[model samples]
Target: MARIKPQALLQQSKKKKGPARISVSTIILFSLIVVLAVFFLHSTYRYWSQRSRIQIEDKESVFKGDDSFLDSKKSDLPGYAVLETAKGSITVELFKDSSPEVVDQFLDLCQRGHFNGMLFRHVIKHYVIQAGDSDKLGAAEDWTSKGKNYNRLYTSLKHEAFMLGTSKTKHDNGAFEIFITTAPIPDLNEKLTVFGKIVKGEDIVQEIEEVDTDEHYRPKSSIAIRRVTLKQSI
Candidate 1:
């Protein structure tokens, strides 16, 4: 082998030193990448855990009504028969007489304040907003959670006059489902069930009809049902 010159020896040393210098930067870059990936994964997992997954088939199903959401002080309170929508304050006079089984079941849910702050998810302008559903709420530990989602069975009765419909009632009478009539809706004459009518607040209902609505019937503003109360007289 030929003897190395001074300049060649220096060049070899420089080459050796260059890799060591690059190694430190490469290690730092790899560590930073690993840290960022770990943080991203943790964030994703936390988001999924906190996200709500209401099943709508987990609430205590009592045909009468159950006071699960209320506190111990109001445990024995009875269910309400009247539903007061906050966006339109329309008073629905439930026809518990026609369909006692379904009405009683719904009344019990109303009394429990199940419909409170619930949105009228299905609002047809000049028609109706079917507003009872518990599955839409987020899964937050702070809020009153029903363990899982609970939905009622679908009623056998077809959509007759004065009747309403809801996606919430895939099973029985849903707690927060309602539909405000658009017009006579003559086509729904004997189809939808007219369980109740707006004793007052027709103007409010009209105003709600005028508000911007989405394809899913969701109102631009959250039209909430403050609470439903049962009354002997309208």
Candidate 2:
């Protein structure tokens, strides 16, 4: 049997250790690359997600009727209407310049007594007080298919909010249904046709909002709208 030299044995040992060291370094390098790649992908996804969310929010903000626009002289005239409820009367100033079509349709309904004796069909605290559900509030069955009824009014007005710009918010023309927000909801600015805002009797609106409601948000006790009369500014 040939005996291996000490120097040769040391060389063989070095060769074996060299491959192990290279394998360890290669594995460490590969692991570092994988970690970096995962981190980059996660960061990129987050950036895009945040950018998309910001874009959607920015688009929504545009339709909130820019504060500068509201301050401008081009804003609507101070025409108002009284919504006489069983609780009290709420005066809402119509936005003729901002939402002319909505105001016109509402006034037309008022002239035709479409909202006379309508119930405050739905109420949600810190949300909205909905009315003009003529279908549910005992409107004449014949009026269902008749001229300028609630259903007809819904289809008449183009969702004016979207006319301002594209939006992700759900578009609701709200042609016949009049809803008063209990709070300043910017999201609703372009989603719903905001024909008017309550100028007076906000307390009455608050009272209506506080009314006891059922699971479906309908007032347990009937809150009737006695009449809706449009008052022009002299």
For all predicted structures, in order, the TM-scores are 0.47, 0.50
**Which 10-residue span in candidate 1 carries the lowest summed lDDT?**
138-147
lDDT of each: 0.54, 0.64
Show the colliding residue pairs in model 2: none
Clashes of each: 40, 0
Which 10-residue window of candidate 2 scores lowest in summed lDDT?
159-168
True-vs-predicted CA distance for residue 45, candidate 1, Å: 91
Task: Write one digit per residue (lDDT tens) for candidate 2, span 203-230.
Answer: 8888888989876667899988788776
Alpha-carbon runs more than 4 Å astray in model 1: 1-81, 134-169, 172-176, 189-191
The TM-score measured for candidate 2 stands at 0.50
